[model samples]
Target: MMKQLKTLLIAATLLFSTSQVIAQAKIAHVDTNEIMSKMPAMMEAQKQLDNLQKTYDKEFKTMVDEYQSKLEKYNREAETVTEQLNTERAKEVQDMEKRIQDYRQTAQKELNQKEEDLMKPLMDRAKAAIEKVGKAKGYQYVINSTGLLLADGPDLTTDVKKELGF
Candidate 1:
């Protein structure tokens, strides 16, 4: 009977300690997407990216038009031109096509790099604000509630936005 009583006392102590630990672990959630959308710096970065995209589109269209014009000209002259000349024209067209493809790939890479370069800092800033607010509020964990189906914890979105000065 004494051994059983001691075991019961130990189990109660462990349960009480576990409950205290659980109560001390404060958690919160924030919507990073909302904060990013409301941020003026993010919007400005998006506008810059859009302008760069437009420039690339215009240049790509010009290259496509030039390629089509050359192709049509070559096709029209294929019958009148010597076989060797026609072959040379075909090779020239192939070279132009390769160049256009290379330009498109390079432009896409540049745009991706530019977007990373421009947005990384803004993202970092938002993350830091979230972290700062979470820490200041004594939260042990701060989850991003962007895609969360259920977030019943305290929301830190407004606090993070205020921290970011937006």
Candidate 2:
């Protein structure tokens, strides 16, 4: 009987302590997308990306127009020129087309790289602010609410935004 009593006592103590720990674990959620969208630094970074994209688009359009003009000229002259000259012009057009494609691919890669360079710092700053706010609020876990279907915990978005200073 004494052994059974001691076993029950130990089980009760363990259960109580586990409950206490669970109750003390504070969780919070934040809408990171909302925070990032409102961030001034992010807005500036977006503007820079947009401008770069526009520049790339304009340059690409010019190249496309030039390629089309040359293709048309070669097609029209194909009958008048000798077979060798026509073949050479066709090869030149093919080379120009390849160059245009290569330029487009290079531009896309450069734009992606530029976006990463510009946005990485802003994203890091936002993440730090969120961490700071979460720690300050005694949150053990801070989940991003973007993908959450249900977030009944306290919201840390406002606090995080404030920490980031708009």
Candidate 3:
């Protein structure tokens, strides 16, 4: 009876540990955007994009304000004014408004493109770092946390974050 009991206990322990090992997963997650934000090159690019956006916004505002002032003046005096001035002033305001709209769209698109361009190297670095860390740490799989929405790989994130110094 004792021998049978010992054998059963040993078999149970071995079976539990084997199953635990089999159930273990080597999955990891990394936030590419988070990594990109910490890159010095990306920071400088973001600064440049911000400055450009501010400058363009100011310019667009000035153009719109100028047009609005002219339009308001025209409306105030339009009833008493000759048809010639009315037509010319209306045309000017329309042209100015169109220009402002175009400039705003262009400036926004340009800034977005610049931001994308600036992010490339940072993204590359992050990916490279992830690859390196994963290999060194025996990570069998690495996934971008961006797509996960939520994940239990917080340990992987913390480790990667520390390793990247981000």
Candidate 4:
């Protein structure tokens, strides 16, 4: 009698689970990368960043070139002078090299900060858009590419993109 009761309980649980699975829950996926690509503001920001990066590159190259020229000229002069001059000049060159390295590192950090500063507003806009889109469309849950990979589960990304154009 106990075995029969347990079997009935298990059967009822399975039926309830199946019903829940078949419930009317709207689910969709949104590809964030697609939205970012389509956003004109984001594109413009990227172009600005590209130009800034090029300028930074040129500045760094000019600095290195100037240093190299000075080092070359010093070597030539040292070849014609005493060992004492060579030692002093070598120390000077090493100090200059260290300063250049520090400058390069600082410049890179500033560039990264600049990118974040430029992009923060755009990112916030995209996030707000996601919530706005989700609420308006009656989606119980909107999933992203990141979600699918993180869960290692089925993807509804295409359906969401088709429905939302995002």
RMSD of each: 5.4, 5.6, 9.4, 6.1
Error of 4 at 39 (Å): 1.3
Query: Please, what are the lDDT tens digits per residue for candidate 2 over residues 28-86?
Result: 99999999999988899899999999999999999899989988988888889899998
lDDT of 4 by residue, 1-166 (tens): 9999999999999999987975666665677777666677788989988898898889888888988998999978977988998898899889889978987898889889988998898778776667666767676766676546554433444443444444
Instruction: List where candidate 2 sits over 4 angstroms from the true fold.
Output: 1-24
Error of 2 at 141 (Å): 0.6
Per-residue accuracy of model 1 over 5-92 as CA lDDT, tens digit each: 9999999999999999978899899998999989999999999999999999999999999989999999999999999999998998
The residue pairs in collision within model 4 are none
The model with the greatest lDDT is: 1
Off by over 4 Å in 1: 1-23
TM-score for each of the candidates: 0.85, 0.85, 0.73, 0.72
Quote model 2's TM-score.
0.85
State the local distance difference test value for candidate 1. 0.94
